[model samples]
Target: MKKLVFIFALSSFALTACSKPENKPVQESAQTAPQESAQTAESTAASQPLAAGDTAETSLDWAGEYKGVFPCADCEGIKMELELKSDKTYELTEEYLGKGAGKEFKSKGTFSFDTKNPSIITLDKAAENRKFFIGENFAEARDMETGEAIDSQLNYKLTKEAN
Candidate 1:
């Protein structure tokens, strides 16, 4: 009788340990289905905002190379090269000439233009003495190089390079 009781107890313990509860499978399935549906709904909602922000002209059309030359009385020739990116950002390289012997002084800066008025370019440097201005065309940039006022004839105009 003792042996039979011990065998019965051992069998019951093994069956209980090996068998999963009746509600476990249903609970797991319910939890996983909701999580998956929530993720799908979130992803579908997230994509709408990105699509809304995208328009036909979302990117700047002015992304290209440009060059300009301004005649300077104090310098040999003011030559400027600009590389514009689709994000409305640009890199500007300028060479200034000394008044008499055509000595060249070079400088560079990063620039960005307002999306509303793409013609208005803002230039900044690490030195923190920055200036902003608006121009109708590239040639109208009076403050391209030095922020100080220069002679009127020293105005520079930017021209888009032919593809």
Candidate 2:
């Protein structure tokens, strides 16, 4: 336990030493900032009511089932049903429409929101890094290769089903 504590102390010291140089400019500016300007900035910030920025990530009731028939090149269409849970897990089922003698393909896995863009989600281990852009009442499937919203006239959208 002594060795472990010493290693942790050394790691903390190294991290603090590495970060101090990068913070020098910000620290210098704060130290030299005018007192009156700082007071004015604080008062201005306090006077204005804080705006609640409600984004899709924070506001949308997104945990539910979504279903739609997406366009397919080889078959008539592809019917996909997806269920998103609050625990960052998902259940997906797909069936090729008008393709006879085939069973519904089902898969379940954990999903994660994009770190930089929380409005999008990608299911773990999905083919081609399949992603979806979540929006109001829909989760649109994005292009597998480009990871962008599909721009075709044919709808690739899944409508949220009322529970």
Candidate 3:
């Protein structure tokens, strides 16, 4: 439709107009030529590496296998294993034990880090909503919908497996 095209064009123009150019020179300079040159050099150095906007907060190492036994009401426990790979994919396996017939289930899918908190990860296209709060040598399960950590003495937690 003409209105939709107009809206799309308007949105693109607004985004481009508002976005800041990385290579733009600093407006203020020092009084002396030597100081000015030094300032420019510093500015350029600071901007060069970060022109693509890579930051430590957005990049984290969370690749490993985690295992634990979760408490279950009717069964002895639920044995859980989760593996996260560097390519943002994951494998999850679960086994219900001591319920007359032990059953195992495995799910494989891609995962993504939460934009607000990179330490939190969620499974994509999974049958059951699952979220993990990643920490040193451990990944803890949280409320699937709210992403809030469950509070208990015997918390549902997974320890990283030895490489």
Candidate 4:
């Protein structure tokens, strides 16, 4: 067993010691590494130009009144007006169109922007999870409980009204 081990080790040493570095021409893959890296950097810059370390919370002029008409199943439509202030506060007014003309539902609360996702804001209410996706001069209503984007084509977008 000792003789077999000694022979195996000697053969392995001889095989490895006899190997030499190749003197072949460089491949195209090695030459284009810098080009590929530059392309990667350019693509990254182009893709994230609006979001490259600039979230909606930090980069947008978001403090204004946004008005929109949301679809309602039991009524004509829901007229919603939301104003996000600079002091981390919000005012929301909703009116069911077909239900009544002057019957407005009003609420005021403090809202917070999500730190991890920077575009999502949650209304500071305990009874419900009223979240909105903050965009450039607009806010879109999200799901009630999960804060996910509403998967409907009924135009949940609210446009920023000029103040």
Top candidate by lDDT: 4
Sort the candidates on lDDT, descending order: 4, 2, 3, 1
Residue ranges of candidate 2 with Cα displaced over 4 Å: 1-53, 126-128
lDDT of 4 by residue, 6-33 (tens): 9999999877666532222245556777
What is the C-alpha lDDT profile of model 3 across 112-138, one tens digit per residue? 777666678888767375888888778
Instruction: Please report how far candidate 4 places residue 62 from its true position, in Å.
Output: 0.7
Backbone clash total for model 3 is: 0
- Could you tell me how far off, in angstroms, the CA of residue 121 lies in candidate 4 after the best superposition? 0.5
Q: Candidate 2: minimum summed lDDT over ten consecutive residues — where?
A: 49-58
lDDT of 2 by residue, 1-163 (tens): 9999999999999999989986997787777777768889899879985444445557888899999998878778888999999998899988887753265788888888776567788888853357999999999998765568777888988999987
Q: Assess each prediction's global lDDT (C-alpha) against the native.
A: 0.57, 0.83, 0.79, 0.84
* Candidate 3 wrong stretches, greater than 4 Å: 1-60
Off by over 4 Å in 4: 1-38, 42-53
Q: Give the CA lDDT, 0 to 100, for residue 36 in model 1.
A: 96
Residue 72, candidate 2: Cα error in Å is 1.3
The residue pairs in collision within model 3 are none
Tell me the spans in candidate 1 whose CA falls farther than 4 Å from its real position.
1-60, 97-110, 115-118, 126-139, 142-155
lDDT pick, better of 3 and 4: 4
